[model samples]
Target: MFDGVHLGHQSIISKLNAISKGKDLESAILTFWPHPRKVFSPSDDLKLLNTIEEKKYLLEKNDLQHLFLKEFDEDFRNLTGEEFVKQVLVNKLKVQHLIIGYDHTFGKNKSGDFSLLKKLGPECGFEVEQVEAVNYKDLNISSTQIRNALSSGEIISANEMLGYNYSITGKVVHGKKIGRTIGYPTANIEVDAIKLLPKKGAYIVDVFVNNTPYKGMLSIGTNPTVEGKLITTEVYILDFNDDIYGEEISVNFRDFLHEEIKFESLEKLIDQLDLDKKRTDEYLF
Candidate 1:
């Protein structure tokens, strides 16, 4: 999976484009859908960084010409390294110059590695190269690291690795008008269940409404102060006072302000909201 298409992934794609252009071969990316873990370990509840559409949108902005999303099922998983190289890479894609990451593996049980590809390249009439890992502040940038950063509410670190802001796109849905009573009107957002959400916290964000950007603060957690049970994603856009129910918007996470806290009373909650707003304005504006 190109997952976040973080810096490391971008390095590989950059190398792929350079080599393909030098060799005069078409550039492309081959990824699998339903994530292999989803097929083999359904109980893991694996959240993905990008939905398929999001992946396509991200990849389309890159220099590559084609993106092949192969369905990964039991049958596809059972293919041996040689068989996969022969059937998929050689026959189907007609791959001539293949570029992969330094740690990439494929085929049954992940038996395929750089060595395997090197061996098969000559026999299969193709060339192979592996891009070195990309690093930031001496930290190896990878999808796993980005996920961990987001899971820990380290939005700044995650964005550094991603080379862009991590964003959530969803539809505005009606929420209990609790925030309005507290003088902070909010819009409830409903996103795809499988999209990986960062840790439950308050974040400084840039909310996009009708393609226009506005400063905002977002909360991703249950309304514990209000005795709510289900987790909710709500954003209070600063200076934006409009009914946006059913509107599609995107929120680009900037920095994590604080973690969710349960207040003793509504007065306490409102006080915290005031502080949050103050901090958000200071940081954003």
Candidate 2:
């Protein structure tokens, strides 16, 4: 899974688990890191739905027997379909059965599809199975669809496809402390550079501090009202007051509240914040 372990990926994993049980075999996943895209297009601003840490957590939660993470680079990418299966899947992994997503492809030029795999399975002494696409409201659930929904601020649809809230983990960092001046102290979050941020807007989120959850409102954007120059992710936790700087926290995006707005003055900004808090309270209750 490149990004979020959305429902579509879960479907494939679930099948792997089920088939493993039926055959009394171990289930394992062979995933590539430093995504192939990053290797091919080094300069592109490639953001991901889940960090490597998050992906590990999600996969482990699925109870897979083993995880084989391999680095993806020019050398690895150059391997042909036959070589990949013979050397990696057969000799290295000793995989007796391989369950792949319906659209899954691999090896150089993506020449390894179901047909290619099936043709080689007999020679390789393995079985191949493909899990059909999982659908949500007639739309096929996929990472691309989830990413599109998130980038467009459609959190509800995205979460529906994910089977969980879209979340980001970051560390609390220092800010200008302007929110404190406005009676709404905020926590400025510094997330991974490669993490995909949702649309620049206001959102209702659940803040997890040391694994405990709290309600919060998050704003992601450049502070246009304050003439700020850099993009920031900030959150105001309701009824919370603590020194959490340097602490790692996770924010689960629950709902899209509104777009970031530029106010005429600090007073106007405070007023909108009050309204946002009110809406957040109503929604949470």
lDDT measured at residue 255 in model 2 versus the true structure, 0 to 100: 95
Model 2 sits at a Cα RMSD from the real structure of 1.0
lDDT of 2 by residue, 1-285 (tens): 546888989988888899999999999998878878899899988888888898888988998999888989788999988889999999999989998887888889987889999999999899998889899889888888998999999999999999999999999999988999989999999999988899999999999999989989999999899998899999999989989999999999999999989999999999999999999888852
lDDT of 1 by residue, 151-235 (tens): 9999999999999999999999999989998899999999999898999989999999999999999999999998999999999
TM-score of each: 0.97, 0.98
lDDT of 2 at 273: 95
| Pairs that collide, model 1 | none
Question: Alpha-carbon error at 132 in model 2, in Å?
Answer: 0.8
The reply for model 2, stretches above 4 Å from the true place, is none
Best-fitting candidate, measured by lDDT?
Answer: 1
Candidate lDDT (C-alpha), each = 0.91, 0.90
TM-score of 1: 0.97
- What clash count goes with each model? 0, 0
